[model samples]
Target chain A: MTGVTARRRGRPPRAESGDTRDRILTAAREEFSERGYEKTSVRGIAKAAGVDSALVHHYFGTKEQVFEAAVEVAFAPALDAPDAVADGPLDEVGERLARFVLGVWENPTTRKPLLAIVRSAVNNETAAAVFRGLVVSQLLRRVAARLDLPDAELRVELAAAQLVGCAMLRYVIRVEPLASADLEAIIARVAPVVQGHLTGP
Target chain B: MTGVTARRRGRPPRAESGDTRDRILTAAREEFSERGYEKTSVRGIAKAAGVDSALVHHYFGTKEQVFEAAVEVAFAPALDAPDAVADGPLDEVGERLARFVLGVWENPTTRKPLLAIVRSAVNNETAAAVFRGLVVSQLLRRVAARLDLPDAELRVELAAAQLVGCAMLRYVIRVEPLASADLEAIIARVAPVVQGHLTGP
Candidate 1:
């Protein structure tokens, strides 16, 4: 009902602002990517978005908040992927988790946000905190809840170590062979390893 | 060996400069750690070392060369571990590799340079490239040579991904449980995963 009513309005106020907010965030992502966390600023992001400086602050509050919001938007889709991954067969959870996460890296859209996080997170404490919280509390916790094991969190983290490391080399560091290897080949070789971390003896 | 003559020198010109070079490199590593790659400058590094900028340039040509030299020294001890690691029992290679690599991170001395690289590599292309060269060409290649498999190089990288990721989480990001878990506990849980990546079908 809310959706229908909102759609019916001529130049809906909320939707219009929502569009503005999205525009600012998109600009913020680009700014951070090009200049990094420390060098990027609200005024610059606002200028890039073609919005008033006050309005940028009004929408995002602060630069840190802007970073938080931008990553949240970028990571939104990937966060939902593992939301459903837990209900499947226990035996194949590793492949499912590995593929889904790596699949996010494989896809350009999801890859950009994660790449931003991975890129910025290394140099800045704020970025690293945000990345850790998102991967652990939001992403891994959802997966861990399904395992119903005592050491599920540790297991999940170790599994994450493997996946994150591979992605770092292949995508971030852009190392040879693995960086260019077929996605399926990596999935085949890496899936079982991820599985071992998730459910090994 | 030449070691005796070097030790016997009364202010040997070579050893005196070697000490100075070590001091400058130490200052450079500290600067990189604190300010990151982009914000760091050769002038600032020289200032920290209490040396003339000309001497800094004399010893290490540019900022990039300084970074390469700093990480090379920081990683010097670690670079040697895998050199001998390849000669060990193949089946136990995973445990030995994991223990040694993670051990490097575990030791405060070796960990500092690695921490600098991991922290800086995310945002800087040069740092990432240098780290990739060191870890791949210098470190993983040695271990891969011993595997004698067509896919050995890829396999070794995968194993590195796992260890590197775990170290990132544990040491850099400082994620809980895994970060604070007893070192032995991490090795016990993570070694098999590394083994799987190394030799699994």
Candidate 2:
């Protein structure tokens, strides 16, 4: 199903170019989630998507490109999260940030891919570097700039560490007490520490 | 070798039972560090140690047991770290904990196996559960007990989250600036957040 049949016959296809690309990305996500970044292959993704390997390469130039695209698609919902915290008063920023992140993970649709990314990123070097770059530049630094506090960068990173650590424990590792604890309770307990990092004396 | 040459056919060996176990553990550490928990096998460890696979099975009941033993051996240096914080004044506990944990990671010798464990734990469910159990019950809970504060368990866990998150970024993920930052400076920036978790209003 390399589209060889469609191309040779010169027939109008049911799926357009955009649909094929989407299918490749969806397949890539599934592959990455199941096997992780290191073990995932372009050929595997292409086969899963019912396309030729060349087509996958055509849509995404490289494996890294496809992974980057996958990460972009997976994390799209939280791209605005830093701004969400930025618009709020300084004191309440921590709670808002916590809620936004936990809410993203708590959602059924979003959590699947994100869980894969977080789990895979930790084990794979390339994935970790990509994830680190996005988190630091896109999410953490942006919030740090808005705070205008001394050690602003460090402060925001520490806040991120808290929340990210919480996510790792609760969602990925499934650490108990924290994992099974009520969402609001965790927010109440964790927010103050984050706030301290952001604006404390 | 199966210790056949080292052991006598009719007499007791002089090296003692503990020496054999220690040798097995050392080999296990090397294998686990290089290949991680999932890929490392008892046979591989036995081959590396120049012992028969039966010897490994004899010394450690199973792969999980060997891994647990390896973790214990690897983390032995920092096993007392929580108590080190527990012995100090409440206000300074955060600094002590941060300094101790970071110091362990910053050292070349300790960081290797810990890195393997952290990286492997994220991608593998069994490893994650084992790691979660050890960190929570053995490390974090001991410190939480010393706090004697309300929600002390949750509080200590949150503190653990922040430090664990920082470790994930600085060591495993290699997030820049934070990764390259001076050790004491990070301690200065992170200690307060931990303090808040441990002693916040």
Candidate 3:
């Protein structure tokens, strides 16, 4: 007879084992979101995850790593953005980029982690460094490479500033009608401005 | 000696007192610019001014107050931007706005306090709140009022995003060649884009 699967296997089953890592990341995200970088501790993430603090240390090594894991999980969707914008026609590039960015921000799944990261950067040195690294390496560098223009890097940087600043006002600061306007309307009005920065005379 | 000499008394004394207030504000601006909000303390401002800490506090009740004083000093020039842009023909509006903004950031006297406030906002909730309040109340709201568009507020916000984002990348992040380029060239390229967001098709 097939023996009952051992409740405590030598190691946790692979499928279920991955769940622990995910849970820890989720808990860390929540803690960081609510408390910010300086206030968030590894022990707090463990408590929230309902795991031993040592288990958290065992898996992530440090609070910064835990934070990094949370950021990676949150920003995972954005990694595809370059491909999405790059695949589109040259003229429609701005609209496509704007839509992809707005789409990421509009989704609750992504917005929470983004808000957390932005808030932390505004209030912590460590978090700001991480944010700068992610934006520079992951997002801006790709866009800069794609643009063929004088001061292409500056154009990309300007595009990023415009995008991020708009998001900050709309979502983080909740400044007026911007926070309440339809996403498509925003795209139509602002995308070309960004496009102009990227490709205009 | 008899009765006090008129030259040394009354109005001149008041003028000297005004000079002290100006001196304190100037010193605070330098301190905040060089050291940022968190690093620059009350004592530091006082020491820089060669005055007592209590006098610094006496003139400005708190560090936040000192920051406010410094911002008022730095932003007085920028406050005129709306009027300058508004007075011009709509076609030239973008160029004018861009020039004014770039001029402010490029000026060492202004850039310091502005940078301090921005850097502080990234790491201090109080600072961020103050910044949000200033931007929303002073800048965005004014721009929104001037625009005759459907979503005027959103447009203003988008315009602001473009402006502030460029500043972040060029000045704060100092992203390469853009940071080192000729001011007029940068302005010519970016202003039209910003203008489009403010008053575009």
Candidate 4:
């Protein structure tokens, strides 16, 4: 029976290591970054990863799921931010949040996917819905829960707007001067304002 | 010959009465508000306006152009803002600017398109690019030119970020409390911050 099964198989089973998954993710990130989510397809990702299309589907059920995974991977640094904020002095929360968020944008490895999501969210409803869901559910909800204030939800949402808007101008739009300014300079100047929005009376 | 042609046309062959153009603009505004820029197509706008699809093409060659027209129509109030700022005392410029901007967002007629653009800009590259061009060239440049400060450009951009961020939270995301709060109260609270950004030391 084993011999018959081996004969029936077209080729030896490929290595089942997680390397293929990582490669697929990396390829997906690149493809999504270069071409927004709508333009990117599973076949494109598979071709980029040098893997079978079926393998891509086997690993990730749908393109949206793959896109979500890519976003999560890109936002991995941001995902760790809650722990970092928890570790730091409560007073320094605003500064830490600013630094962490800015750091993600400053890092090339993450910026591509971040930019892709931002660019896609502008024109694509599905992408916007997904992005909005991630922001509201994952990021804003946690930040809001951590805050000890009246209207905490509103405050957190506003704080997020401040940070996201700064990011939109500085990184996504690449507006002059703000775009070229030193990172620390920006962090120092903007953190207090964000802090004011977050915890201020 | 002109009279004969006019008679042959049945109606007086009115000089492209802006009624159709106005209807398309209105429909486009609603479509964009409800469906956003990417999902709302020319055909959809035409259908909504009860006009032939070809009329949409004849009126506006492309979706981008239509979007531009829609923005211009929607933001007619904002386009007057620079002149308003330029006409007023420089000292009150910040407060006036804030009032004008918040007022626009507070008005339902204007707020919808503004919200649509903000939401769309997040995901669409072309839309983002167009938004950046309009903001930088039309709005920020004008404001910067009016400022007597040393780093007028940076100041204008920063002030813009503050205002845009506030609007992003208050409207598009519908952050509670602030979203439902009095506009004058917000203007009073944040105008100074904007003032500081624009003219403060």
Candidate 4 CA-lDDT value: 0.77
The parts of candidate 2 lying over 4 Å away from their true place are: A1-15, B1-20
- Give the alpha carbon lDDT tens digit for every residue of B3-102 in model 3: 5676456566779878888888888888776656767798988888888999989888999988887787778878777677656677776677677767
**Best candidate (score: DockQ):** 1
Residue A93: error of model 3 in Å?
2.3
lDDT of 3 by residue, A1-201 (tens): 234456444455785868898999999999998777877899899999999999888888888788887998888868877777766687887888788777878999998888778666655667767777786767767776787765777776667667877786677656677778888888878787778777776
Q: Count the backbone clashes (under 3 Å) in each candidate.
A: 0, 0, 5, 8
**Residue pairs clashing, model 4:** A119-B123, A120-B123, A121-B123, A122-B120, A122-B122, A122-B123, A122-B124, A123-B124
- Could you list the iRMS of every candidate? 1.4, 1.4, 2.8, 3.0
Better of 1 and 2 by TM-score: 1
DockQ for each numbered candidate: 0.65, 0.59, 0.41, 0.31
lDDT, candidate 1, equals 0.86
> For each candidate, what is the lDDT?
0.86, 0.82, 0.76, 0.77
Q: Supply the TM-score for candidate 2.
A: 0.88
- Per model, kept true contacts as a fraction are 0.71, 0.66, 0.57, 0.41
- lDDT (0-100) at residue B69 of candidate 3? 76
Model 4, span B1-201: residue lDDT tens: 999987767654363457788999999989987776677899999999999889988988899888888888888868977788655788888888788777788888887888777756665667667777776778778878899667898877777777777786676555556578777767766676677778877
Deviation from native of the Cα of residue B192 in model 3, angstroms: 0.6
Clashing pairs in 2: none
Classified by CAPRI criteria, candidate 4 counts as: acceptable
lDDT tens readout by residue for model 1, B1-201: 689788686676888899999999999999988878878999999999999999999999989899999999987767778767777789988999899889998898877777778767877789888888887888789888988899998999889898988988888887877889889999998888778778877
